[model samples]
Target: MGGSGWRKAIRGFNLCVYSPLAAEGGGDVGPPGASYDPPAALSPPDPPALQLPTPTQSSSGLRPRVSASGSGLSKRTCAICLTTMTPGQGHAIFTAECSHSFHFHCITSCVKFGNHVCPVCRAKWKEIPFHVSSDSPRARSRVNPVNMNRRHAHMSFQHPLLHNLEPCIFNDDETLDTTFKTSGVCYNGSINTVEIKTYPEYSAIPESISTDNFTILIHLKAPLGPRNEISSKNVYVDAEDSRTHRAPVDIVTVLDVSGSMSGMKLALLKQAMGFVIQNLGPLDRLSVIAFSSTARRLFPLSRMSEFGRQEAFQAVNSLTTSGGTNITEGLRKGAKVIEERKEKNPVCSIILLSDGQDTYLLSPTLHNGQHTQPDYRSLVPSSIRDRTVHNVPVHVFGFGSDHDSISMHSISETSGGTFSFIEGEGAIQDAFAQCIGGLLSVVVQEMQVRLECLHHNVQLGCIKSGRYASWVTDGRRSGTIDAGDLYADEERDYLVSVNVPPDHHETHLLRVSCVYSDPVTKEVINPAAVELKISRPELVGSQTMSIEVDRQRNRLQAAEAMAEARASAEHGELSEAVRLLEDCRKRIFESEAAKSGDQLCASLDAELKEMQARMVDRQHYEAMGRAYVLSGLSSHLCQRATTRGDSTNSGSFTQTYQTPSMVDMLQRSQTFSPATRQSNSKMRHTLSFPARPKPR
Candidate 1:
């Protein structure tokens, strides 16, 4: 108040107190002990709002920002309301320090009477009136984006569209598929990256089913908020088991009985074959073909009855190693036996075991069709691949370094089979055990899986990880993935990214569909759908979660980087390769799906440390590089996308290219030759283990 105004106000107060009419208009001096009441003039009206200067800097030296035009400001937001912030029609003053904007009255009120700091950032500010209730958005909700991701990290695959699920009834004998999915099986059993976490409470498994043919797992991960550049949403999945099946297999063993298969190698081969024989079911059929200078059917295809097995055992015992490897003749004869019985038993297979020592044979071994040389790239006839369950799985085993890996891998991949590089002598049994394990656990055939998202606002693409059989997408949110067979405990994992278009919803629906043919039932199970859920805009908990998933992704990035680096280094772009590996390190750092920075870095460093000019060493390094990349893939997928030696023409560096990520390589590698009539003489060259990979 001004001095004159103050005197007038004081005189007025004096007059009111002394006057008899006041207290009733109290007399101030006379009424010593009496209580006095002030006049109406004593009560002042509301004061004018004192607007303060705009804040230039905060306690932390963060400049406060004001939006004059306020383009992005929404009017609906008000700090005084103490509710969630929404954007729409509002004047706002955003403090750049905290990135929180509030109404003009909103902030001044808190500064004037309440705290001297920003509500969101907790930064100290000069005096201002900001009366905010404690019930306002708490520290957790108002925290920055990174902290948000850490809080809501739990995964959920909500109720799948519950369309047609018959109340599944189960007996005590039925169990969940656990073995193949349990440990580091997805990462060569010795990965130290992402931690595997399963939210069983968030999962829904159909229990009490009378019979379980196969299963489909779904993982729908997304940030709880708008996606940022550093992290992308991903999905991890695995399914099916191997411990439940009575399906009979019609198997033909094609052995490379060349001179190379002498001594202990021959003994191990015999023992491996014997193990398979011993494990055969009564209804299963087996045909043994021993090939050396020529192919001989040791025993024609026959059911494994006691007498039939005894006779087959005798025939196998009488066989002896001899001349050059006529792999074509063996597969040709084996194919005939398998093709005839395919109609009865869909699971027909041809196992080719070779030492690859006959690679230099000038005379090409001939059989059913054409006199083709013993090149490993010889394609198996379509007649053999078709007409059987999925395709006649032409499993090939490469014993000794001399084995034709190119041909062996070709046969296995062409017919969706497996190729095992049996290192060391007498390791044929290990290869055999790997092959037989799958053959025995076979259940459903022609299995195909698809992941379909129903929302139009979001799209998921660049799916990596799972690539065992094949993966085909429909140019949008739906994908058809190959899941060859339902084994006793074998699993397949898929990692896919989410694409957020404008107008994304708070949640999304993910559909996992599996179609397969039950071997025993002889019935086609088409379109078995499983449902999953995705959280909208990951806020906190998810950002730091599932370290194991991150490791898997890191492995993939490192693998791709290694492949590219080797390609560059081989072409004398050593620095380029180094840069690529460095890029891989960054990718590993930013990868939200998998994170194994230390392992990948250490591995690459070790490989570079061993850089010598030895051709064999280089080749091994290149192959190891490819394997390291593949190591990130699901076990089944890595096996399917196994490297086919070196790919580029400029130099020898192994580069693995699956159709999903490397379509050009797929087109180039997939060679098709016209089926010409065979001159009753030729060689169709043929080829897993759950083996632990030794770090290079």
Candidate 2:
């Protein structure tokens, strides 16, 4: 009668008994009338089908729902109701910027009944789209167009918001026309080597742009890692990967043996050329050409074998300076050498070093009190251009203060190459080293990006791709951007301003795809295209934006200021140039990225200050200031970091500043070893040479 007695009785009731025939070792027992027969073994029953976890009923008396996957299993749970959310089951899912997700109804109910914060994370709720019937008879409107414009303008200039809306940026009349002419500026140099990765700034756009337009910034980056500042091993590479192998280079070095490059300059030039030859590998090819009154190929393109390099050194050492400077002839000879390359698909480029202006190629005269700049592009043959000449970049170096910087910069820009100012005797070697470093580290070639608008209502306002050509087709619905060769891990950004209409409601806005060739494999790769989609709601909260987009936009604006300042300085408008630089500095400080302690913004700010100081008056502006400003502007516009110098002494030049180009920072930051690091360091100190200013 105790607990133990009850347990024993329950065990007896649950016990199982075998059949008599089975216990007696007989086969099986059939029906009573049938004879005994062997029985077959019984198989196990099938497992139960998978089912989604059904959420429990809520305290608020809401019915529990089960969210199911393909396997009919629930993966997500709603925090508010303690219920599973069914995706695509007429129940909307709201994802916050913090990446927390909840059922739309649950979150909205919570927000309405509770505080305006996420129930799960307690973070401020964001990006909740709303639909309201505005302009209804019962609805009171309090909208001000003028106030909206002012707010938009503030957001546009203070941060990387809608770039086109800022009047200070475009300085143009507002027009409803959507057609935009692509303004291309060379960010770096042209086509030659590796795989490039591309991605969009944001995954989604807010539905309503009735008050302000949306801007999309797409980034094309080389997968190069951050550089080791103290080491020469700058580019990060997986040795196991074939794509990272240095591409074979075919370079034509054009030197100026003009009368101006006589003593220290000539000696330094020879040394720089020798250094260039030493760095080249057996797979690389080199050629040398010298021009003064005429151009002559001192050395033809030959493999950089030990013996071949010896011959190159001899040719460089035997260089002599005389006669008038003939830059046009030098470039022509260099182009001719490139055309005669023996290597197939090698990284081809031209290095032009000049110390003086071409005596025959004169600067245009002022007409009607306006400075008529000479057409430097017309001075060079079509074959020398990047478009015509197999994308050969012509990297030009101005050796002295008197060297025609405008013409040199133009030639480099037109050819999709970079322009460097080499004033110091020792600086040329350093400049050459940096240039060659970038050349050898190329990984991607002939890169191009295409942006296609998915909706007809969505229009591309403009594409700000530094130095590369971009054009909108299909009546501005689609656009193709030419992104020149990127070095290992070098990133290029394209700020695309899109005009989205209010009536348009689509999930997908644009498609971005890139086509690039790998120099190592000699294979063209077109990766799967990425789509840009944003939900369209009648109204939405301020969405979280990409900091990278903001940073790139800020860079573009700073570069624009540099360009404007350079033009003002060129036309003898010193005060205007200074004003522009000051304005740029103010914007840089006000930028969100800058306030967040972005290093690039700080560098740009310092550069603007330096530029403003350089162009304070006409006397300094004409002396060495014009070339200094041009060099800075060129570096910024081209996105190619260059060492700029001014002659403090007639016998030698001293470097004044170096432009911190994004490409140079990303591509060649680790290029300078301790031995070669002196070049960049010594550039900071101003040396007193008591030199005479070169004639304008």
Candidate 3:
């Protein structure tokens, strides 16, 4: 009852509203002596300005303290610590590698404590400028870098970190061979239809006035996914080593004139020797080591000329097979000949040819009163490989599939040399010529190609670019392909499976980088990059792939498949290997990627014929596998050899190995001609972009 009485009394109690509108006489909203008015009639006082909490940044990984875009110097705020770059606030700098702009103090702090990688792209960050040669020609778009952190108005040319560094691979020699050649799996004869892009969305620009860096070409073929499907991107990075500088080569041919090479083999050897002699420039030197029961230097290293060449021809022909095969003696004498020029540091090569295993060996025979160095390890078929490890290279060719491949292969592999196998009875000559071609194809001494994936969607499977390449490395973010010694106008293809993004537009994917040591100067070259872009079917009306790309892609895929097939065949799966090639042919046939189906079909038929030989004869298979591995080239690669005779008879098949012919490109301009398509006339096309304010 008491609680109910208190509630009733509280309800009956009177109260006055307290607001700005309250009046003196109990509640009509008005000021004293003025008309009553509501608080809404008066302008609402602005609420206290909203204050946001400061965001936090974790300090674990590389985080950029700078932004990507900017205005004039000091006109922007620092992205790191929420401070402007105006006047006393700080100054800023831009890195071309990642194209990120940052305040001096903030970026310095980031570099010192925030790890060395770029915040945006996470690329290796360097503080110094490119340090281009003052005498070097600069691009019209290039501007002198500004130093905004300092008070001085002048530019400093002294970049201590990069000073005295020579142009690792810069040249203006337009006469270098630029023709892009390939063994056709699709289009052949000329590279006319190949579309080259410096970057997607840019027109093809000719390299008239250019920088001295390596030229990189990107061939993109983005297919239209089956209606409304987001299409995947297909890109190929084609890099050309345009710097042409000839270095002197000193060669020592170790020929096996054993009894097995008495007739056709001897004649082929003579022909192969003649071919080598014919291709040698006057500056090049050659020495022959004829080995039978005994090894002797037929002639010391001699300069080739009309008269000298004649004498060499007579000397090579003079070699007649009689005694047992002494391969160890041949290698020993050959190494001695090249080791003679170790001090001169000439490009030394030891080319060994043998048809049978080493059958005889005396301690170390004297050739022209000089004992063979180190006695070829005093063994049947062994040599001191250390000499050829760096300065000289030992290339071995097993003829007729009877030679000890284990011994010959080990010799070449240890010496950074190439090992090739010539099958059948009389193909030794062709094999020799091909060996010589490969020997002469040394442009970059120590070369490595890296594919850095720019986007997370794409990656590559690393494969050895050549048998001569040391090794292929798989990295966390990139694939490193070992490209041993690149030849003049020699194009090597690699197949990498790209995981396409789930249908995106305006996507940029991979970056190809080349690092090599120049043979002429021995300078380590690095930082060559090619940005790859693709045209998605969604962006373009029709999906069309040029003959050049179409053929190369097919060849690359086929080559990779053949490689797997060869491996499978070696494991006793002959049908699997043949199936690989068949599958490749079927795909090409269905797609109509080949310019001439008959030509490609003929090539396939020839390929299948060889592969079928491997299936029937284990010896043939071993020979083919050994050669394929040594060449580190595709199945379509038959340029070094010319075959004649029935494919079934290994003895009847004759091969003459020779370097591929090169097409010279004289001029590159806007003019259109059939010759331009065939030759290496690299017409550069400029990229399109809106004009921007010039930088100081």
The true-versus-predicted C-alpha distance at residue 684 of model 2, in Å, is 22
Task: Please list the residue runs of candidate 2 whose C-alpha ends up more than 4 Å from where it truly belongs after superposition.
Answer: 1-212, 224-244, 342-345, 363-373, 503-506, 535-539, 542-545, 646-696
Encode model 1's per-residue lDDT on 1-696: one tens digit a residue: 111010001111011000001111222211233222221111111111111111122344321122233222233333222222444534334452445555443343233321245443345555443333433442113211111122233312111111012112211111112222342112111111111112211122222211111122233211111111001101111222112233566788988878777644564465456545544544567778778777665545666533334334434433445688767767776676655442455466888888754434334667788776564444465566564434687777666556655566566766767665554443444345445545644555666666777666445555564435445466666876666664433334556555433222243445666666656566666543555543433232323445444444455555565556656756766556667766666555566442344453344333333332222244554433323322222123443322221222111111221222122212211111000011112311100001122222
lDDT of 2 by residue, 521-558 (tens): 66787767778776666656565456667677777888
lDDT digits (tens) for residues 1-696 of candidate 3: 110010000000010010011112332111222221111001111111111111222343112122123211232433222223455523444443666555443343334221354432335666533333435453112222221223222322222112123222312111111122221111111111111133221212222221122122233211111110001011111223222234446788888888888655664466456556645544467877888887776655665533234335445534556788888777777766654442332356788888787776534568789975433234422334544335465767777656665566556666656556665543444445445544543445555666666666554433323343433244435666555554444455443433435334444556766666545456665644677755344333333444444554555555566678767776888777778867876776665456455354445435545554555556666655545443433223322232323223442222222223211110001011111122222221111111221232
- The Cα local distance difference test for each model comes to 0.42, 0.56, 0.43
lDDT top scorer: 2
**Best-performing candidate as measured by TM-score:** 2
The TM-score values for the models, in the order shown, are 0.49, 0.62, 0.48
Candidate 1 total steric clashes: 80
Superposition error at 85 for model 2 (Å): 93
Which candidate, 2 or 3, would have the higher TM-score against the true structure?
A: 2
Better of 1 and 3 by lDDT: 3
| Displacement of the residue 418 alpha carbon in candidate 1, Å | 1.2
By TM-score, is 1 or 2 better? 2
- Measured on C-alpha atoms, candidate 3 has an lDDT of 0.43
